[model samples]
Target chain A: AQTVTQSQPEMSVQEAETVTLSCTYDTSESDYYLFWYKQPPSRQMILVIRQEAYKQQNATENRFSVNFQKAAKSFSLKISDSQLGDAAMHFCAYSFNFGNEKLTFGTGTRLTIIP
Target chain B: SQTIHQWPATLVQPVGSPLSLECTVEGTSNPNLYWYRQAAGRGLQLLFYSVGIGQISSEVPQNLSASRPQDRQFILSSKKLLLSDSGFYLCAWTGGPGETQYFGPGTRLLVL
Candidate 1:
């Protein structure tokens, strides 16, 4: 079974600073996908960023980017220029590259933006 | 662009009562759909997924069951509810396997 882990249970960063949330996974499959999802107090699960295992280049969306280390089995999310709106619960998830696979999610990291 | 939606934003039901949650997708056809449950302070758990209108695959064995009667519609139902079943239920969809799954706003279910 594939598993995703977010070592940091909670994290805080000052406004305008950069925060990197750590994530690692255990998978025997050679091809897969990693994702970071954000859930605010409203309980909406919003997709933050996604990284494909086959892609050597990492994924970046606006202020959100990932440092994907496939050999190390690590996928960390970096939030740059953090704003108040960035405060939320972040979840790391995994899915297989083929078949109708389900996403296996980590426990989540609660992010607090100290302004 | 495609969008996913789940109904009954919030619900409170007594034990042994039935449950019915609906999810629909717009601007997409024959997309893969999924049902997930997030227990308080826990990660999201995949309950079921469907690749087509009538094909449903369950990830975990539980009191819940899912059905896809239409190409863009999925339903989660339970014959009887339990207190342990209380949680925030989320519906998601993707174009296919390995694709980024988009989530709905989620429905909060509280069984007392």
Candidate 2:
């Protein structure tokens, strides 16, 4: 069984500033995927960024990036030049490379953009 | 581009009533489909996933059940609704196992 943990329940960042959301997971599998999903007011789960365990380099998508420490079992999301639209509930999810397609997700961190 | 659709953007059902939610994917074939429930202020909980037609894998034991009648159609159902079942239901699909998943606009279900 795998479990994901998001220690922060809520976070706030000023517009145009940067913010980092922490996430950690427990998994015995060596091959896996880590993902960050954002759910805005519309309730649409949008993919923010993804990092493969095999890839030592962190994944970056425009204003979003991740600090993936495989040995530490930590994958954190970093949002640069944050905007009001970035205000949403962010979730960290984990999935094995094979077998079932089910994803285990963390409790989530509610991000608020402070004007 | 591939897309996913979930119906009844919002639903309200009385306790003990039967419930059904439909999800469909377009522009793809034999894609992996999944059903997730997001409770208030919480993250997603994987309820069920299907790799192919008639191949449903349940992740949690609950009042709900899922079926994949067709390659692109997935349905979530329950014989009777429970207050605990009230939450936002999201339908997602991946190109295949281990691939990134794309999600559809979730359906908000309120069991009163």
TM-scores for all candidates: the values are 0.98, 0.97
What candidate 2 gets wrong by more than 4 Å, as runs, is: none
Candidate 1 Cα errors over 4 Å, as ranges: none
Report the lDDT tens digits of candidate 2 across residue range B45-101: 899999999999998999999999999999999999999999999999999767899
DockQ of each: 0.81, 0.79
| Every model's TM-score on chain B | 0.97, 0.98
User: TM-score of the A chain in candidate 1?
Assistant: 0.98
The alpha-carbon lDDT assigned to residue B55 of candidate 1 equals: 99
Measured over the true interface residues after superposition, the C-alpha RMSD of each candidate is: 1.1, 1.2
Residue-by-residue lDDT tens digits, candidate 1, B2-59: 9888999999999999999999999988898999999999899999999998899999
The pairs that clash in candidate 1 are none
